[model samples]
Target: MELQQMRYVIAVAETNSFTRAAERCLVVQSALSHQIARLERELGARLFERTSRRVRLTPAGAAFLPAARQCLDAAERAAAEVAAAVGEVRGRLAVGLIPTVAAVDIPGALRDFRRRYPQVRVGLRVGASDDLVEQVKEGALDVAFLGLPTTARLTGVAARELARDRLVAVVAPDHPLAGGPSVSLGRLATEDFVDLPAGTAGRIQTDQAFAAAGLTREVAFEVTTADFMDRLVGQGLGIAMFPSASVHRLTGVAAVEVTDAPARVEYVIWSPVGRTPAAAAFLDLLDLPGPGGSAAHAARAALGTR
Candidate 1:
């Protein structure tokens, strides 16, 4: 099947409406439909099941979607590689980060990257550190910012350490423990806590700290974003442990140093191989220190450019 047919199928699957897909593809409904039908006939499989109320991907379509996407991505990368050989970068840059990332100013960096390479399309996704790392490893994300426990190890990816910080106890201004000189993990464990979801890299650090301290704490609320954790702490619903760098930004919450608090390292992770030119450009903008030189050199090495 032609690449155009695959594009049309992807659009229809994503929008679930032929008319909307046509609009997205910038083509008429009939033309998009005709291409998909032609593709279906060639494959001898009905890609979509159409009904008056809705359109859904058939089993064949479900199976075909991922391969179609991979084909398009491979084709785009081929084009980008050709462009890069001539000292021009063109492609998509997909970046993922946890909400509590503090080492890099994402918006400022993106702004600069766009100014430097206007041909590259940029996309950002906010997710857990583990998920972001996995996405980078899978090549779904070109780069990711991760905050993991100081003891955590990264595998199957190339990474550069950005910053490190100890977590602080976050409590409402009126909280009984708010004015403390410093709190211990044991003391903090005595109170209810608001935390990132269990098992997440963000939460694992705190969980491990408490466990190592021979204490058990109750998590009164589990939320994804630090803002929600801060809000809950501001309401005196529960206390939270946040990276010290992030505490200053939280309103109505007082940060008390935790003597035995967990320390986290912020890292930027990318694929160990197959570095996209766009990804390389963005990493260069980060300008992280490396053994050889700037991260850009590493990116170039990954692209087989000595």
Candidate 2:
């Protein structure tokens, strides 16, 4: 029932070993066991199944885990809010971003954020844009950086557009199109392509462009990471369309402008209902320019600015 007991339970559940959990919690094995036993007695159910070989959560423990986590998170957030009221921002900041994020240097930004808010713990997750947006909406992430085709729409979250970029065609140096003049979508569509997995935001942007152009293309290779996509292109496997800003950073591939290409908008999204103090501080550090003024004003206008 106590917050400390909940913390101990989480540690045990995560480590799956009472001895390891005790080490993780910086408590003796006996004290950790005693506290968990006390909690089980109060709840009138055994939380764990202890055997000579292993310790695992019982059905009741599994059912109680999520609620326990929520309660602990709530308590921590409350304490963080109290500290923020007096000008100290100390909390966990969970930030999610797409792999091809170019509008802001993520590592640099994290460095600056850490320097400015040394007390805050920051965690980074790299994922697809749609997944990151869902995490933000679900409150699993405090904020997220996303890239979506201009034609796409986002709902139920507050967002600020960071930048807009046009995708360029990337080809191997020995390929036919390398070093050639800018190519049209029609011409590029004829070539094999290496792209992110189907249905991903990055892939969908190019797909929509091709569809709009009355064209269809083959994605010969589907890879998860941009590095692998670059490797495939360098090996003459296929061509790819990626943000123009990032193409220059890739070696062994030549970038050709696409006459008719897809454009993606970068955005930073957060929950409109519960804006954490740490998240607010990070947003302020960005100091992004909105359509008319600061990013703060633009986010208030929702997706209407973009």
Candidate 3:
């Protein structure tokens, strides 16, 4: 029987009189009597022995009483759990990010967001942009930071452009093109390119730029991870192209300005299928000015770069 029916049976058993039980349950006596009668009929057994002035439990009623109480307790516990999940901010939110985005600004920004919303339990996952897109689409992640134009048409998801990330040249300190104010596209043509893999947005941008400059890409090595790309460049493997944000000094790589490359726009991609309040809070966090958000001012203060 239904949980409400169990509750009705329990109420009638607790109070001896039908009228008293209905008053306690905020139902009319006849309605309560009818519900108990229906329950007894469904079970094919009498639950109570009724007299003119009093109601007492039958053998079947005594057997069912504990079970009825247990059913109601379970139902109430389930309801309370649902209410906690909905009303509280302290639930798990799985967030995904690509290496470059995670390395650049997201880590610091997330640290700040965690400090602000400590009640939220965050689960962070890092992967390639395409992988993160797939995770978001498959409902594996609540939210993700990825490059734009996700496979939403194929998978039913959407993206919002959060910030613009531009490409820049990266190389070792002793490289031949290192001393220039700005290396011309024609001059950069001769250097072997330590490149990103073919499918990545940065790689596509580099391919287009090289084609426009009438320069052929002398493929040096294919490195996908931003950290590894910087490391490969630092070891004098060849010059690599990456978003300016990943230019943070980590593995002895040096970042230089590349004016001719296409800009890489970073976007926040997520599925709304199972969004929680914490996920919305994360979107709001993206709009706030955290550590490096005012990059111009923060950069000037840190690197003294004009």
Candidate 4:
């Protein structure tokens, strides 16, 4: 009828004597008998056969024992799993990221997070800023990195500023423009450009930099993925604009600093605002050195970077 009743039935059956079962269960012999009798009546079946000197199971008792054991086992496993998660000891943590963050520091952070919480599963998803925001808001993702989108009119969600992903112009190394000196914002439009996708904040910043230089940008191509933009620049498809940290492998493209360029702010955002221990651990690790900065700022300086 209930776990307590099942336990009473099992105790009496195992000890095979009312007195011993009562002693083992820490109950009076009469109380133990009443508990077992209650269970038998609830199940509409007798679970034991009593003789003057001893007790033995009815066929029903033999059949029900394993099921009782199974219930106890399942209850124990459930409690353990819940405890592990609340203690930050284990469970799946779903993290979402905009393309740039995924390319920038997530790989190393993921490696370290796994080393610390090997029992916790880390699930990752990459998307544009809008999608990342939506994922966290709908509870589809636990947390994610979003390129700082500062539109005041934007809806709900909490954002934690992570780092600034400085935007820079990228050109094929062999291009005539690549041999030139460090350019200013004014010089940005001299060459035709590979554009960021229209309507995105990155694209707006790219366009404004050219505007500030008193020149108009000519779009040779428009792209969404910074990863692809870098690869394409290397192949000389076109000069691409992207976050400086997201552009790697300088073999074919030179990632040059653009003076007076607007830097994109990156943030780690969560849907519910309050963070899980695992997610908080990840955010804390990001502040460390190594991939977070140049050699001047070692691993210890990572989190200290504003």
Candidate 5:
């Protein structure tokens, strides 16, 4: 019934350890347990199933988690709205970014945002695009910059395209394709490739493009970071593909345009529930028009700002 109880439950669910959750919430283990017990008793449902090794959410807990997050988001938005009325943006803003985000100057934007609202606390989380999108939907992140297909349809999230960058082939300067203006996927079918691991946004796009072109390459190395991939290609370990903007400044690698390759679109996505004043201000820094109009206006309407 109390807001603190809801927060405790959410913390426990996220950490899956009562001790760690209590530590994160800045409370004693016993007090956190007691609060959760009281909340379970009030609801007449077991929210979590505890065992010796791990704590797992029950079916009821899984179902209640979204509503609990929405309650917290609504409370934060209400508080932010009151502060925004006074032309003040002071709140925690959690933003997520993909590892290979290159189309936007995120660091520069953050620098500007800090100068504009020094009181706002900003937290950044870096991960793959899919992971970032899930975090935004779960309310763990207020906004996320993701690399996605141009036609990507994300449920429970509102996304707006920021910029699109063409995918290009990267190779060592001495490689056979390095001197070429552009290379076809079919030309590299038999070549060794350094690629992102499967399930990442970049890998998925690369795979789809190859599949569409009826070409397959041997993956000699799988790397998680773009810089690592570039280094591998520079060493002649294998050819690789990445966004043109990301590979333009590499020293030992040459980025050749990929003939007929699909472009990856960079999108800024957020939960549709609402945005805190700090989050809205950060979006304003991006100057992105929402799917309909101004993203800031949409956020204000969602937050019930007057």
Candidate 6:
């Protein structure tokens, strides 16, 4: 069967609508339907069970989906390899970033990478640490910057420790604990907290720290962005626990060290098996030494460079 037919099937399975899949594939609906029909005739197996209301993959479709995706990925990698052989780093690199990551100068790194490899295309996605991690695992992203537990490991990926920073207590300047050198989780047990949602790495780390301390704080606001959470804490709505770097520059919020909190580690993680040339170049930039020069040096120390 043609590679186009495999693509059409995969798109239909992902979007669950022939019309939408056709739109995504940039073809007319009738053409896409005809191609799928031809593919099924060639294979003698129906790939989808369609109704006017919805589309669902058949048992056969489910069985074929993973292989279809692998085929597409392999084709793309082959093309990239040919370009790399010519000393060109030309391919799409999808990078994921967590909103609260502060150890890396991502914009600077991208700028330098683009300057060096003008032919390479880059795409960026920002999400929670867990979501970004999953995207890396699913091949939607080539690499991701994540805040993971010190000892936590993800299956099927290789990670490099970029930086280690302490989780701190964030409070409004006027809050009672603002002037403290450090605060204990036990002391904040009765205070209202502004926190990230349950599935995020930040929230998970905070929860574990509280559990370890035998204290539980009331969460008054669940914010998705670190900047918004800083504003919430500044408004005196509640306090929060966040990585120290995330709150270092807040105008009205004070980030006090959490004397008993666990340290959060930032990692640059990627699939070691299918790394693209662009990904390899970017990772090399992350290793270059310097403190504040080019993007390559912006977070160099975090990458364990001298």
lDDT of 1 by residue, 47-95 (tens): 9999999999999999999899889988998888777767777889999
TM-score of candidate 4 on Cα atoms, chains taken together: 0.59
Off by over 4 Å in 2: 46-59, 288-306
Q: Lowest summed lDDT over 10 consecutive residues: which window, candidate 4?
A: 290-299
- Which pairs of residues collide in candidate 6? none
Candidate 2 Cα RMSD after full superposition onto the native fold (Å): 5.0
Candidate 3: segments with Cα more than 4 A from true spot: 1-86, 102-104, 115-119, 148-155, 272-274, 288-306
Top-lDDT candidate index: 1
lDDT of each: 0.87, 0.86, 0.67, 0.67, 0.82, 0.80
Q: Give the TM-score of candidate 5.
A: 0.82
Instruction: Give the range of the ten consecutive residues with the poorest summed lDDT in model 1.
Output: 289-298
Q: Report the error of model 6 at residue 263, Å.
A: 0.7
Worst 10 residues of 2 by lDDT: 290-299
lDDT of 5 by residue, 120-148 (tens): 78889888888888898888898899897
Native-structure RMSD, model 6: 5.5
Measured on C-alpha atoms, candidate 4 has an lDDT of 0.67
lDDT of 6 at 184: 82
**TM-score of each candidate?**
0.92, 0.87, 0.60, 0.59, 0.82, 0.83
Which wins on TM-score, candidate 3 or candidate 6? 6
Candidate closer to the true structure by lDDT (higher is better), 3 or 6:
6
Model 2 residue 281 distance off true place after TM-score fit, in angstroms: 0.9
Quick one: ranking by TM-score, best first? 1, 2, 6, 5, 3, 4
Off by over 4 Å in 4: 1-88, 102-104, 149-155, 211-214, 285-306
Native-to-model Cα distance after best TM-score fit, residue 106 in candidate 2, in Å:
1.9
How well is each residue in 1-306 modelled by candidate 6, as lDDT tens digits?
988999999999999999999999999999999999999999899999998899989999999898888788778777766776555666778889987788898989999888877777899998888888778888889889989766567677767778898888888999889888887889877789999988677788888888888877799899898889889999999998877787655667887887897788998888756577667667777662222223223223223353
